[model samples]
Target: MTHAPMADPPTTPAQTAARVLLGSAMVLAGTSHLTVARDDFQAQVPVWLPLNKDFVVLASGVVEIGLGAALLALPRERRTVGWVLAAFYVAIFPGNISQYLSHQSAFGLDTDQKRLVRLFFQPVLVLWALWSTGAWPRRRG
Candidate 1:
């Protein structure tokens, strides 16, 4: 008979806390995307994108909310959530690049140095998603 995979516990307490914090952060950021920070988020939307900035921001907000909620609610699927969240971080990275290159100020990253520094954090977000979800350092046989 076929069997379901078991929910794997986080490798450490730090991982658990990371998962909770990152998930909460995502939800909060998404909320801001659809609310007070809409214009700030729009400033980061690449000019080359054919879609409307507001629409893009709103859609991404919904996506973030869903993914964040999933990460928090689906402990059994933590690994998958981690991978997906990491990919999402990667997918949104171009916005960061655009913000830096186009000199679009938002979220207090007004200075070139600040924007450049922000770029470096994308990888950390990816790592955070992976580590928190126990997706990286793949299991051994």
Candidate 2:
């Protein structure tokens, strides 16, 4: 009797590199949220939101570190991690918009044009998270 061929490994080197890069980015950003760049992150918080800016920054920083760690540690569950990360990116997008609309300067996005340009990068980050973790195509067996 003939046996079926084995499937390829779920993650390739490119995927691994993407994971590391994205994870590292998240960790660094999270660190910034909690420490030296806290004001920069706070500047993005929407004025209309009732939540305290510091609390939002602290919570999101914790989440970023957790998600970054999961991306690095959970090799078998990378896809799930990716979906969550993508969702996280989606959830935070309003901040990006707030920064643009309010003309709040943060992370060197001082000008209205710069803030507007920065707005477009959020979707790219979402895509990167999904692609890195093998969640974008809804992978099949």
RMSD of 2: 4.7
Candidate 2: residue 50 Cα off by (Å): 0.8
Tens-digit lDDT string for candidate 1 (99-118):
99999989999899999999
lDDT of 2 by residue, 1-118 (tens): 9997553248778988999999988988888889999999999888988999999999999999989988988877788899999999999999989988888988899999999888
Over 4 Å off, model 2: 1-9, 138-141
Number of colliding residue pairs in each model: 0, 0
Query: So what's the TM-score on candidate 1?
Result: 0.93
Error of 2 at 6 (Å): 14
lDDT of every predicted structure (CA atoms)? 0.92, 0.88
For model 1, the superposed segments whose C-alpha errors exceed 4 Å read 138-141
